[model samples]
Target: MMSGLRRGPLASRFSPSRQAAMKQSVKLIVGNWKMNGLSAALAQAESIREAVGAAGQGHRVVLCPPATLIDRMRTALAGSGVAVGGQDCHEKPVGAFTGSVSAEMLADAGATVVILGHSERRAAFGETDAGVAAKVEAAIAAGLEPIVCVGETLEQREAGDAIAVVSAQVEASLPTGLSERDFAVAYEPVWAIGTGLTPTLEQIAEVHAAIRAAMVKRLGESARTAPILYGGSVKPENAADILATPEVGGALVGGASLKAEDFMPIVKAAA
Candidate 1:
């Protein structure tokens, strides 16, 4: 266990109902389409819905396509046991920002979840931890589950700062509003996303354990049950091993998610 994570009465005092709920918490498998996905992709979404319906329960599956496909995918996947989500949302519910989508708008468009603070957003658009916290609050207010992301680059890992850096990001980026709401945290090492490389299971376990400790310290016992998802170059071939890692509550898949044949195997692994 990481420092400060030793169980105290507070951590061990969950009620019978809460204990059962925690034990039954389903694995969450999310597919992030990112800047890919067009209307034509709805077919893939339908196929996944069909597969998951046959696969039965034991896990939760969500698909986050570009904003353009949120509504269409939601409609197509209706009653199929799959959920639709947005890639990002503005912290404010409404504004003249012209090009930004708000959490309320995402909810209105049929998105039940929103991904915030992805490394791409942080590195490319200069998003700060405070900014992600603000967005988390907005998503909660709008009734959308937020999946807050945090990670370190190769240089930071090489410098032996991966755990510390990611721990700090988890502390700063997650808002208190998330304490009672459904949400997830995704750890996607900047160096591994789309690189066809992955950290050893030991490394993944280390970071995920650190993240869980950070979450519990910040949010108390309620944080203990929230899923901590792994992301990067996740695919069917490696999904089982990664998902089997201790503290890994699920996966956040990228390119491989674009096709049902590729994505379903990962979901099956979680199931």
Candidate 2:
């Protein structure tokens, strides 16, 4: 049974508009649990399930736990209407990559989505756009939707090159022939994640719209239908306003996603 909560003004006001957006609404709230989580973390999946159940359908909710916990989270979310995803996956299906998990392995573990080219992976692990593209291809081949992350640093934003930088990243990171079902794009503004700084609603809209336009140019009609989510300093307080913005489908929550109490309202906001 789904949990139920009264619809607040935020939820009610968007009904008609949201219904309209729903047709093009690719809003997704993905929780990147990152390197945190063990068996105990699985409990949060229930909390997330309850939250989504209470919110009652307005957004798509996904949980990308560590590989170790993907199967557990998958089982926990079964029939719960929430999607389970993987934090990352290797480009190769089989190899001498000792510590890496392949995209096929993730799909076998029951993951339906995978996050690729996250800023951390790019910066810390030195992953290139070409590498990300390979992983994106592998993920699609394995029947998983890759939420390819693209972003620019504060320096780039300050230099007025945010769009140009992100545009290049999107174009290079995405594999050719991407369809709405095969992937989603996340614009996480590298400097914003967990920094408590959100782009103004206008800035958010501009970047998202730019991403959509890029998609349309590359993927045609499917690009318009592809959900482009916003990331970076996204919290429950701001989730509603951001998600309500034009071209803003959903969010890629970072630090806030660690707690059910903190994350649930953001889910509600999306709904």
Which portions of model 1 show Cα errors greater than 4 Å? 1-25
Candidate closest to the true structure, highest lDDT: 1
Model 1: per-residue Cα lDDT over 157-181, one tens digit each: 9999999999999999998777755
RMSD (CA, Å), each prediction: 5.3, 6.0
**Displacement of the residue 190 alpha carbon in candidate 1, Å:** 0.6
Whole-model Cα lDDT of every candidate shown, in order: 0.88, 0.83
Candidate 1, residue 253: CA error in Å?
0.4
TM-score, predicted candidate 1 vs. hidden true structure: 0.92
Candidate 2 matches the true fold with a TM-score of 0.90
